[model samples]
Target: MTEEFLVAKDLRKRFGDVPAVDGVSFTIRRQEIFGLLGPNGAGKTTIIRMLSTTLEPDAGGIEIGGRSVAEDSVGVRALIGVCPQELALYPELSARDNLVFFGRMAGLGSRQAKEAAAENLELVGLLDRAKDAVRKFSGGMKRRVNLAAALMSRPHLLFLDEPTVGIDPQSRNHIFETILRLRSEGMSVLYTTHYMEEADRLCSRIGVIDHGRLISLGTPAELKSAIGPPDEVTLEQVFLNLTGRNLRD
Candidate 1:
């Protein structure tokens, strides 16, 4: 059996009367790319935050590499990297500088941080732009740098939240290739995306969530098999069928 690298069991969280995440559970195996699919306000980000150790669950448990998130948050943090939906880079800093800073923040020495910055920037195809100010780069370029910054720590698992949103197609494909390369090299990824096609193409298995509950979990083919037309069906249709057509804020 494949080893489970991360596990979340009956995770729960709430804000006042509103439940942000309610009894969510899933396990990610080594080298697997798991997709978390949900509409806005579906508690995807909440779950990501809890797993990344930024937020604590009110109930339940998260274990990464057999360490409890609530008890060993620092250890969990060390094992995982995060590329948040929002840009976390310093716009005024050069790409290399930003990465170096993040690497240092991850506790690498000056020389080691510089080396990691160079290596990761190269990995994201941004090494040529190393000295360029991030503010002057395009949206896709900024996103690439953000991804590289996350890699400075050499994490075993990665959480990418809308990594391709608002980017040009070429840049999007670049990011996709980068992700595939990481998976090829045995990195586990927890990918969250609104693009059904992306989820279809990249994820080995997907978990669909609505109202903070995991509504469906299956391979893309399996999910489509249940709701898709006999002749053909898109992931979007399966998503709509499971979560409804109502708009979310």
Candidate 2:
């Protein structure tokens, strides 16, 4: 049986009387890509923050790699990496510089940071562009750099929050291939995105949340089978059926 790498149970968080997350429970198995699908304002970000050790939960328990988040935030930080939706690079710096900086932040020595930067830049297909200023790169290139920066920590679990938001198809595909490769190498991921097709193609299992509560949880096929024949039903249909068609904006 696959081991559970991350466990979250009855997670509840509230801000100024507004409940951002309530009674959520799930487990991510080792090396699994578990996707969390939710509408805007549905608390996906909140959950990610809590699990990543940035935000403490109002009520709940979180364990990553058998270490309690509340007890070992430092340990948890070492085991996970986060690539947020927004770009987190210094525009004026070279791609290599940005990666080395992040590597240092993750506690690597200068030599180690530079070495990891080179390896990760190559992994993201950006080794050839490593010396270029980030501000001069295309949106796709910047996105790839963002991913490489996150890997400087060599995290066992990666949190990808909308990692492919606005990149070109080639860059998007590169990110996809990189993620699959990581999974094959025994890395676990908690991915959150609004792109239904991405979740369909990548996630081994998915959890759909709305109004701060999880409404459904299943493999893509199982979720699709809920609304129609698995082969005939697209994930978009299942998502809209569960979360409705109202514009989140």
Candidate 3:
């Protein structure tokens, strides 16, 4: 097997008496988007938090680029980028300014920050609107800027948590294209989303989580094949089969 770019082993986390992530383990290889699929409160964000070093796992461990999260969290942080589910942009700031500010915060010098901001804006197809205030942009445009900000660090791996949520179809497709292009350029991605088609289209491998546990892991084709006859099953069907069709609060 190829050496893993990121690895989570037996990860466990809890909030008071409730377990949020339990014994979840997975590995992401280079140049692939790994999808995390689940319903609301299925520990998807919790896992991303632990991997991104926002929260320490109550049990288990994570490693990035062969460095353990406990021993070399700073190193791990240096190699990863995170675009959160919520907008992490400054509404009053211009898109260029937002990206530059975040770039500097990620440890870039002023010149480097500015250059990276420009490059990422181009990458997300937002260079033309770089000077507009975030609040004046549409939802899709804001999301583009949010994603561009994360790339300021030039991270080898990126975590995208519901990056297309609440955006129009046009913007959603734009984000999808950007992700594919990133993978082509050798960026590994850990993508979490509730959209089955998104997982089916973007991810080389999909992990289904429910009740704080990883219930299944495989390529979309492999997963779909497992829960149905021949090639007839969809990722959505496989997910509902493994996680059940019941509503989750």
Candidate 4:
């Protein structure tokens, strides 16, 4: 397999007169965790949408596993699993049912869907609560189920958008461990989050986006070193220095 699992070139997207993504480009390699860090309205979400084949770019191009996103969206979708920032779950359904439903949506057979649901639930430490209604579960528990649903596709690349947002420390740590384990198992991940420390700990490389453009790209150590002494510099410091402290809408 090629080292590069995902590639985008000069991607540009405009909504009306506003350019949401302006000439953004990056690549995610096999078994690598690539972080995309930006404040609100940085266009990372637009980038993710284009990468995941949910939204077509008005300009530029994208290829995942050598298949062009515009020409082969079906093929691209088969190789990717997207865990969106928003919860995509049937809250009234049991956790097991929710996963099974998503598995079926991913094109698994009924038997395969059930089996995958059980496996994913176990993977997320939610097997014991599989039959519980999702509405009764805590936010952390629901987020775990969301991750499990995304895995039903058995994808080669995963798009995780703010996966640990608003979760407890235990849930966040569980997610961190899960992402690391997936990478070790050869899954390429495109991760986006507002948490600089999380990116610092988990990403092999990080690309910082601001005002709809890629402003910086490097390993966490390199990025820190760019701002100050590596050991003395924090990712948050680097982020603030690059993006400034102004509040984003």
Q: Which stretches of candidate 2 lie over 4 Å from their true place?
A: none
Computed on alpha carbons, the lDDT of every model, listed in order, comes to: 0.93, 0.94, 0.93, 0.93
- What's model 3's TM-score? 0.98
* Per-residue accuracy of model 2 over 3-120 as CA lDDT, tens digit each: 9999999999999989999999999999999999999999999999999999999999999999899999999999999998889899999999999999999999999999999999
Q: Name the lDDT value of residue 15 in candidate 2.
A: 92
The CA lDDT at 226 in model 1 is 94
Worst 10 residues of 4 by lDDT: 175-184
TM-score of structure candidate 1:
0.97
Evaluate model 2: give its lDDT.
0.94
- In model 1, the clashing pairs are none
Give me the overall lDDT of model 1.
Answer: 0.93
lDDT of 1 by residue, 32-135 (tens): 99999999999999999999999889999999988899888988888899999999999999999999998988889999999999999998898999999999
Which residue runs of candidate 3 sit more than 4 Å off their true CA positions? Answer: none
How do all models score by TM-score?
0.97, 0.97, 0.98, 0.98
Q: Write the per-residue lDDT of candidate 3 for residues 49-113, one digit (tens) a residue.
A: 89999999999988888889999999999999999999999999999999999999999999999
Model 4 C-alpha lDDT per residue in residues 145-212, reported as the tens digit of each score: 98988999999999999999999999999989988988899899999999998999999999999988
Number of clashes in every candidate structure?
0, 0, 0, 0
Q: Provide the lDDT at 74 for model 4.
A: 99
C-alpha RMSD values across all candidates: 1.3, 1.2, 1.2, 0.7
Highest lDDT against the true fold, candidate: 2
